[model samples]
Target: MLLRMPGVYRPQGDTRLLCAAFHDANLPPGGTVLDIGTGTGAVALTAARAGAASVTAVDIARRAVVTARANAWLSGLNVEVRQGDALTIAAGRRFDIVLANPPYVPSVVDVDARGPARAWEGGCDGRAVLDRLCAAARDLLTPGGTLLMVHSALCGTEESLIALRGLGLKAAVVSRAREPFGPVMRGRADALVRAGLLEPGDIDEELVVIRADRAITDH
Candidate 1:
């Protein structure tokens, strides 16, 4: 069956990449999967199609949840999309596979509260959202379960790796792509320049896709 996801979904490109990467990792069939920041339910639906028995998708935006559910129904995929922050979801809820394409757009400028919550906004240095997600992922994963995340290279990839390792999660770079800076970063730079956080000349930036996995250990 063809998969249908929202084109406007933030980090849509990375979301698609991570979904394909997880499938390629040979995750056990019929395992429960969690897709954090599941905009459009792409990764969650992909996991379901790849033989996950249950897929739970969570997002901070209610509209994202609604859109994800609609996409799931349209694609005939069974996925549970919930409206809640990833950090505050049900405690003790564990999954065999946890996947995320978080916001990695670092900015010195303040974000607009009314703006669409792009899944990839990393604060200041671009690791804000990623830090929260990685920390929470430690508790959300089951023994022997795996966590897959896609992030940008400019967002201090080394720091992110160290953070995950500090959390006792084994990390690796599974895939990467070099792309021009996204609008978030560009806009952030503009805002920062106006606010004196950055110079007008410091606008060009590069993006990379870094995938990390958390290895589950047996007690």
Candidate 2:
């Protein structure tokens, strides 16, 4: 088990799904990895154990940063855990691999969510954070590098794929699973329906792992 702070996003179906897909992709060994929105640093640790030469984890929450750092130390792994906006922290850096389990639950409250809700409440159609990541992914990865991101299909897997492709990254859905509404999703089901993201009574949600690779052939 890993250390978990009160407000950090916990590892669940989506987390395991991303890790599994990433492993199956067989990313090149001894490469650098960047884990954005890394709550407990689970993905970062996974990358390290997968033979990545280096792993950098970033989270916006202070508690999450502490939790991830503690977990990394406890696991006796070397992970550079940073507390800041992922984009800001990763500026001018490129990695051979990128992993993310971004918040995608549609939220009715507002686009700018806070506290633990910040962990899962995505604005409106639930792409607030996801969209930014897709836009930045191309710049964050080295040529031939792969980005593995997991999120609810309710947030629009096609949108993510399209966004990445628009940035010249080759993108596709590499893995998918149907998961029941978790606490946050269940709590915001009505909001999602109102936002036209879900139909009435849609209890089961589809989670997808999107893979986008910067083509090595590109200049």
Which prediction has the highest TM-score against the true structure?
2
In the predicted model 1, the residue pairs found to clash are 103-119, 103-120, 103-121, 104-120, 105-122
lDDT of 2: 0.88
Report the error of model 1 at residue 130, Å: 1.2
Writing each residue's lDDT as its tens digit, candidate 2 over 49-156 gives: 888899999988898999999999999899999988888889999999999888888777554587777788777778999999999998999989999999988888
Q: lDDT of all the models against the reference?
A: 0.71, 0.88
Q: Which pairs of residues collide in candidate 2?
A: none
Give the per-residue lDDT of model 1 (tens digit) for 1-219.
333344335545576678777877777867998888887777888888888889988987766788789888988889988887776774679888888877676666666533364655567777788878767766877777777888766667787778777877777677775455456656566765675544577745433444445554443
**Per-prediction TM-score to the true structure, in the order listed:** 0.82, 0.95
Each prediction's number of clashing residue pairs: 5, 0
After superposition on all C-alphas, the RMSD of every candidate to the true structure, in Å, is 3.6, 1.4
